[model samples]
Target: MARGRRLMARDGVRPSYDPAGPDQALRAALQDLRTGRWMAMRALLADTTQWWRWTQRTQILAAAAAGTDVVRAWLAEEPGNVHAAVMHARVLVERALRARRERHRRTHELWIEAWDAAQSATATAPRDPVPWVCLLALAQLDPEQRWEEHRAAAPEPMLPPGPWGLLAEAGRRDPDNREAHHRMLQFLYVRGGSGRLAEAAGYAQWAAGQAPPGAAAHLLPLYVRVERYRRDSGHDAALDLHWVGDEAAREARRGLHSWFENTQRAERSLSDLNHLAHALWGSLQFSDASRVFEAIGPYFTPPPWMYRTPDRERAVEIFVQARDRCRAAADG
Candidate 1:
């Protein structure tokens, strides 16, 4: 039997549900924005120092909204608004990514606009990591414009040499910036080939190892597994717990358990929890998976879940089915 199936057959793992408070706050903020309460969203973004957390939530929200009028208005009112500029750039990048899926020819143009906006934001707020994170994301989307080529082309460069350098700069600004590392992992993944995947896994392992205990970076390996599965077998392949080697699997499980021990559910990102829940389900730790499912509630991030099935409705169905099965096993 597969490792997950074997694990599922054994019982005794208890389930615990603790909703991440910060995630809840983010959700609330998003809801407020959706309802036209600009003050709440403005206050959320006004904290330039809290860029890491706000940026992550903002990008997720921007992707979901698919419109940037409010954010654009904020930028228009305060042209020097670093937060607004970064978010606008993120929204453009998000749209560009979506367009790429439809084979839109203007995807590159959107990316360029995002890059320019990100550059402006970085220049305006040299100390903030959010703009750098945005730039790193743009670099990933448009690999041709990474540090090396940009350096060779520009007489004077404001940003660092490449995506690696951009990531390093973002880390320097905020050492434990979850979004920066996530973007780096993504950049590595898109730069395809087995060697890059291995490197990505190594990076994930290293990041997880270096992160403070209970941080969301612990799920990096799980993200790598999803990417690897997609690359190797395409989207429709069976979800394999053994996508990584045995040793890597052990490390991921160890990291997941560590995260579970240290994490406060209400403070964790939905994406992080979703990734953990998916990983647990894949590993056949149904009880543990059930706990994460409860914490996640109804919110679903595209990433690891959507990778299983590109169709949104289908992805939700798969998630609900897996979640139900895991809950049933835990209850039994």
Candidate 2:
């Protein structure tokens, strides 16, 4: 068993597979998961779709159970695999902080390095909006350096439209493909700074406008960020609480919390958690932010020694302790 594989041994919940093979099954793969059957999934890994779904499960199930290292190796085989990068990073960040809280500095460093690799993975797929969005989320990480780099880009020709440009244009075409709308939001966000940031907000509002009654699920989060920004800028976060409005807001809050609580899908989990914590910190939820911030610090916090380690788990914990102490001192 690997270092992290020991996580799943608890309660003897073994991974199981269905009565489906790679080709012969229509939807047999979706069969319910039964415990004490880790051998079932072995053949399934040879396929792609099955692999993808398995990826999700392996991450969530394995990580929550504590088989984080197993998840890491699984993700490693698929380098440049965005999903893997995201999932693995989430675990590294979380476990790192947990380690740090326990004062296991050496182990924490191991995880932070993993988190950075995942963060930089987004840059590998520069053409993809997802990666750029990842970078944007990290803008505050090295604001002076990153902003300077973005600013220093050579003025390349306004070349023929790329996918990102097309997505931007599509928003104007129908002004309604929720996806295109988000694509535009991503573009403006990656562009960074106040002007582009506001433009992203505009696109988000446009998305809200186009979302049908079914759009509330997606719209609420957009609105929350918009609301948060508005509040920060002294604008109003509409306190209106209609039945739909209240429900949407409530669900959005829960969804975000659930995202943070998740152990797998490392990159996304870490990213979302970091964003939530920062948002919480900004909102003065010091204690809540402190816990979350500690949970994934080495990856998210701005520090050199933090970025130096391979055991991201250990690095994160150190970050947590330092941050909490700093916060404590500030409060004191």
* TM-scores for every candidate against the unseen true structure: 0.76, 0.31
Best by TM-score: 1
Compared with the true structure, all predictions reach lDDT values of 0.67, 0.39
Q: What digit string (tens of lDDT, one per residue) describes model 1 on residues 225-322? A: 77777775554445474543575456547656777668765457777777888877777778878988777766666666666765755665577677
Candidate 1 deviant stretches above 4 angstroms:
1-37, 47-52, 64-66, 99-101, 144-162, 192-195, 234-245, 306-312
Shift of residue 214 alpha carbon in model 2, Å:
8.5
| CA lDDT for candidate 1 | 0.67
Residue pairs in steric clash, candidate 1? 19-265, 19-266, 20-265, 20-266, 20-267, 21-266, 21-267, 147-161, 147-162
Give the per-residue lDDT digits (tens) of candidate 2, residues 1-332: 65234322322322222222122231232231233232223233334343224333433333342333544554656665555555455455446545644768565374446447545654553333332332332332222333342233321232211233334333333333333333334334444332344445454444454444422223324333633343343233432221135444443444345444443433233333444444444344456556654455334432221332445555444434435543674566
Query: Which lDDT value does model 1 have at 285?
Result: 73
